[model samples]
Target: MAAALSLLLWAGAPAAAQRIVLPTGEYMDTTSLRNPGCGAPFYQYYQVKGKYPVASATLARQAQAFLQQRNGRYTGTGLITFRFGIDCEGKRLPWTKVLQTDAAYRPTHFAPALVEALYAYLQTLTDWRRASGPNREPANYLTLLSFRIQDGKVVAVTP
Candidate 1:
């Protein structure tokens, strides 16, 4: 069997940051995976709006493809990571919450590529919005994507 590794990342406060590692750099986070269910991700049901029809699995595949094309070693055996926050510019931003993965995966090196692809896809979804639960007051927010292992280890992240 192919060994795997995954990681997650938080945007600010290096002190608050954490990291997870996996072998072959292609590992899965067994937990926190949103299943490809009867409908789109819960976010889609709410403020997130778009005419372009796509599924969660397709989104995952797209992210994996983007990773592979960038020479990333992910073999698709991992849970995803996420983040929801605005930049210094205060633009509504939803992204893959990046994890420190491994020594080779550094913010200065691979972060931009991964984030760029994710943002590009997100931009395609119009009026992207999110709410914590159905029937509750909807909060205008950006959603961040992330993944984690049962033991709290990060699998893969996009920031």
Candidate 2:
């Protein structure tokens, strides 16, 4: 997956920020490409490479704002990792999973709320520009979203 990440980062650089027109004729900013996570055999099998699906900056900012609003009401610190996939049809494949959670925060009452909120925010995202292989067939891509919260504030959100 290192190769894929490298290609994505390279194509996403400011100098290479060309607009990629999808099969559906939607224009996507190359810089919006995100790091498709590793450790998934599906990615290797499909030979998926380069940029992955990502929300527009405006939508991403809105989602972050929503998360921050929800985090403001919580009282503990923790990290949450969410995994999901985007299918060839440019639809979210209902394969969401919680990859990890801090033990202290796992059993908290607000834990479910946080998870649900993130899921909801993800659902609000538009369809991604599908990844294609050498054959030009669209392939599914795995993605990871991580949230780090501290003292009831969201400290970071990583790809």
- Give lDDT tens digits, candidate 2, residues 91-119: 55443445434536552323455556756
Model 1 regions more than 4 Å off: 1-53, 75-80, 86-91, 94-127, 130-139, 147-159
Error of 1 at 72 (Å): 2.7
TM-score for each prediction?
A: 0.32, 0.54
Best by TM-score: 2
Q: Ten consecutive residues with minimal summed lDDT in candidate 2? A: 8-17
Candidate RMSDs in order? 13.5, 14.6
lDDT digits (tens) for residues 28-85 of candidate 1 = 1222322222123234322433212445555556555554555633222233334443
Instruction: Tell me the whole-model lDDT of each prediction, alpha carbons only.
Output: 0.35, 0.49
Candidate 2: the clashing residue pairs are none
For candidate 1, what is the TM-score?
A: 0.32
